[model samples]
Target chain A: MIQFKQATKRYGPTLALDNITITLPENKIIGLFGPNGAGKSTLLKAAAGLVRLSSGNVTVAGKAPRQMRAHLAYLPEQNTLPFAWTIKRAAEFYRAFFADWDEDRYQKQLVMLNLREDMKFGHISKGQLAKARLLLTLARQAHCLLLDEPFSGIDIIARGEITRALVYDYSEGQQTMIISTHEIDEIENLVEHVVFIDSGRAAVFGDADELRCQEGKSIVTIMKEAFRHGSEQVEHV
Target chain B: MDFDATRPIYLQIIDLHKRALMTGELKPRDKILSQRDFAQRYNVNPNTVQRAYREMEALGLVETLRGQGTFIAATEEMLDTMKQDMARSILDSFVQEMKILGFSLQQALELAQEAWQEEESRL
Candidate 1:
């Protein structure tokens, strides 16, 4: 379980994450949802130990994130990989780096994602780049997988492929996945829980089906209503 | 496996299986897909599928054997009860819709009969 005890982050004068206190459960596919610049990335970065919290603390499985780095695999929003390296080269790099990296899963996902081993990172299309990044990230046997905007700026087909890969790779009750995205409808059915963050505050957080059942609306619709009328109507879960 | 956003998805999964049983697509002893496979097939959370399977078991619609897997457990009597229950719910909504359209009971029944005959003729 990942617990953010009154977690707060600041970048100079901007408050990226405001006193956000929430406990994300383990072994479930969680949706970290919000609009652009709503501290979704910051929250994910904090969990991945990439960003330091200005105040409060974030812990993974009752330990600091940095201590749990080996068990966490983080996929940033942008492609941070070397542009000159081929997909095969990147796989080799990951294989040499992470002890838990699964080559068998990598080979299978490489084919499943329709990505050629010889394709250079810079030369491939946007869709392929997204697939390549996802392929590498999922190949790791990490306990907690943090994906930031996995579907952003990609075509519908690529988005579908990514979703398929996530579902295919997901093993119930063994892995914890936190997927952050603004596109709620795309993953409405894919996630078991949702945390709606707006302006760096957790507006609403609850089980997806329970929220749907309680509000008599879809998660997308609930988000729309929550953000449309401010956070007054929302009762934090 | 498209789901209604407003309702619980687990309930919908149960309804889908019940529908298959009603339509004879699933028989009394037919084995169903494992929860993991069902989740992957439907592109949904496995926990949701597990909940659906538990609900099905509670309803006596399916049973899981040790070291084996889940199978359709509805007997003839259970199937009859299921059919009546499902048909009643559908009919309730249809009647409610007709009433909202300002149709009287007699008129609604007549229109329903006509619609049923039209559907049968098409089939």
Candidate 2:
């Protein structure tokens, strides 16, 4: 389980994450949703141990994210891999770096995503780049997966491929996943839980189905409604 | 299948199952896809499919045979009743729309009769 107890992170005068507290349970797919600069990335990064918190705490499985690096996989919004490295070479680098890297899963995802092992990172299309990044991220047998904007700047077909790989390759409620994206509809049917953040605060956090039932609307609609009104009804859940 | 965003997905799945049963595409005792397979097929959460299956079970439309799988449990009479229920829902929505369009009950019935005749002629 991922727990945030009044976690706070600051960058000079800007507060990336306010004194936020929320517990994300284990073995469930969660969607971290919000507009740009809504602190969605900060929350995921905090969980991934990529960013330091100013105050309060964030832990996964009773340990800080930095201490749980081997058990976590963080996919950044942009592909930051070396442009000169081929896909296969990138896999080799990952295998050498992360002890939890699963070679078998990497190979399978390569085939499933229709990616070529010899293709260089810079030569592939935007969609292929996205798939390659996902392949690299999911190839690890990490306990917690943080995917930030995996659907951004990708076509529908590539989005479908990513969603399919997420469902078909998931180790069946064993790994906890948090997918942060503004494209809510693409993942509306995929996630069980959602955390809606706006302006460095968690607006709402709860079961996706229950919120849908309550509002008789989709996640996107609920999110809009929550943003239109202040986050009073969903302060910290 | 385009699902309505305003309604819950499980309810939509139940409606789809009912439509299949009413159209004779699924026979009584026929095995439906397992929850995992159904979730993969539709790219939905398995829990959502489970909820839909549970609702169908409560409605006596489907039954799970332990480790075997869920099966269609609707009998002929149940199918007839399901058809009537679907038709009634459609009628109610159409009447509500007609009322919104400033039509009286009698006028809405007459319009519905004309639409039914037109549909029959086309068929």
Candidate 3:
């Protein structure tokens, strides 16, 4: 479980995360939804230990994020891999770096995503690069997986394939996945829980089904209403 | 499976299974997919599938055996009850819609009969 206790982050004068307090349960797929610059990436980065919280603290499984770094797999929005390196080279580097790296799963996902080991990061299409990044991230048997905009800039067919890969490769009841994306409709059914952050605050957070049942609306609709109304803060727990 | 965004997804999942049972696609004593497998197949969360299975168990529509798997536990009597319950709900909504459309009971029944026949001929 990841718990943020009145977390706050500031970049000079801007408040990226404003007193955010949320406890994300373990082994559940969580959808992080918000408008651009709503601190979605900052929240994810805090969980991944890439960003330091100016106030309060964020912990994973009762420990600090930095201490749990080995058990966490974070996929940033943009590609961070070297352009000259081939997929095979990146895979080898990851395998050597992370002890939890599963080469078998990596190989399987490579074929499933229609990616080749010999494809260079610079030579592959944008969709293929996205898939390759996702493949590498998912290859790790991390306890907590943080994905930021996994479907950004990808085509519809590629997005479908990425969604399929997520469903097929999900570790049931053992892995906690926090996916931050603008594509709420694509993951409406896939996410068990949802957190809508607006103005760096959790405007709404609850079980997806319960939220749907209460509002009689889809996640996307709920998100739109939440942001439109300006953070009414409908929290289930 | 296309889901209605207005309702709870787990309830929809349960309704889908019930419809399959009514159509004989799922028979009594037939094994059902595991929650994880069903989740993966439908691209839904496993927790949602688990909730649907629990609800089905409460309704006596399915049973889970330890070390084994879930199976259709509905007997003929249970199936009859389910069919009647489903038909009544569908008819209730149909009648409510017709009423909202300013149709009298007699006219609504006649329209429903005509629509049923038209559908049968199309099939």
Candidate 4:
């Protein structure tokens, strides 16, 4: 499980994460959903240990996130690969770095994402870059996966390809996946669990089915309500 | 299968199967797709498909034979009960909606009869 205990992070005057406390269950695809600047990325970065918290702690598999980086695979929102690197070079780099990198899976994803090995990162379109990034991250057999806004800046058809690839390549519930996205409709059917973050705090988190059963509404509907309530709380304070 | 986002996906899968049975799209004793195949077709998690299959088994709509895949149940009693239950639920929702529209039961029945006649004539 990935857990946060009063976890807080600040960037000078801006509070990125504020007193977050939640336990994301293992071996489930969790939808980390919220609007822009709602700290979704902060929560993921904390789990990846890419961003240090100001106070409290973030733990993955019962240990601090920094200690568990070997078991973690994080795909940030931005395309961070060196623009000069070719797709083949990127694959070679991943193969050399991660012990769990599966060459077979990488080859399959390369075909699934329709990526060419000789194409440089700088030459590919934004959508192709997104797919390439996803291909690299998902090629690894990591314990916990943190994907931030994976579908953003991509076309509809590309979105379907990515979604299908994730479903097809999913490690049969052995790996925990937390996909952060503002577009709920795309991932609505894929994620069994959901977490709504607002203003750096967890506004709502639960089994998607239970919430649907109790509220008689979809995840998108419930998320809208949660965000509205969260904003109202902010206004009241 | 068209799915409503308001409900759990597993329940939706069962509903889709039941609908197929009612519409003669799925025959009695016919084998259904494997859980993995169904998950891929629906673009959902395989675990979700497994849960749906389990629920269908519990509802007696399907049976899994060892070393083989799940198949739709062929028993007359089960089919009859499933059909009646589906009709009752649909009628119940229809009546509830008509009541909310301020229509009396008799008036609602009359409207339904007229609508049925028109549909039959179109066919």
Winning candidate number (TM-score): 1
For candidate 3, write residues A191-234 as lDDT tens digits: 88899898899888988878888888998898888878776655
Chain A TM-score from candidate 1: 0.98
lDDT of 1 by residue, A33-119 (tens): 877788999999999999999999999999999999999999999999999999999999999999999988999898889999999
TM-score for each candidate, following the candidate numbering = 0.91, 0.84, 0.90, 0.91
lDDT of 4 by residue, A80-164 (tens): 8999999999999999999989999999989988998998999989889999999999999998899999999889989999998
For every prediction, compared with the true complex, DockQ reads 0.69, 0.44, 0.61, 0.70
Positional deviation of residue B24's Cα in model 3 after best superposition, in angstroms = 1.9
Best candidate according to DockQ = 4
Supply candidate 4's per-residue lDDT for A29: 92
Q: Candidates ranked by DockQ, best first? A: 4, 1, 3, 2
- Reference interface contacts recovered per candidate: 0.72, 0.55, 0.66, 0.75
Off-target runs (Cα >4 Å) in candidate 1 are: A230-234, B65-69, B90-123
Write candidate 3's Cα lDDT for B1-123 as tens digits: 788877888899998988899999999999999887897778787767877999999999999999799999999999999889889998899988999999999998898899999999999
Quantify all predictions' global Cα lDDT against the true fold: 0.90, 0.88, 0.91, 0.88
Query: Which is superior by TM-score, 1 or 2?
Result: 1
Worst 10 residues of 2 chain A by lDDT: A228-237
Quality class of the docking in candidate 4, CAPRI style: medium
Q: Report chain A TM-scores, every model.
A: 0.98, 0.95, 0.97, 0.96
Candidate 1's TM-score reads 0.91
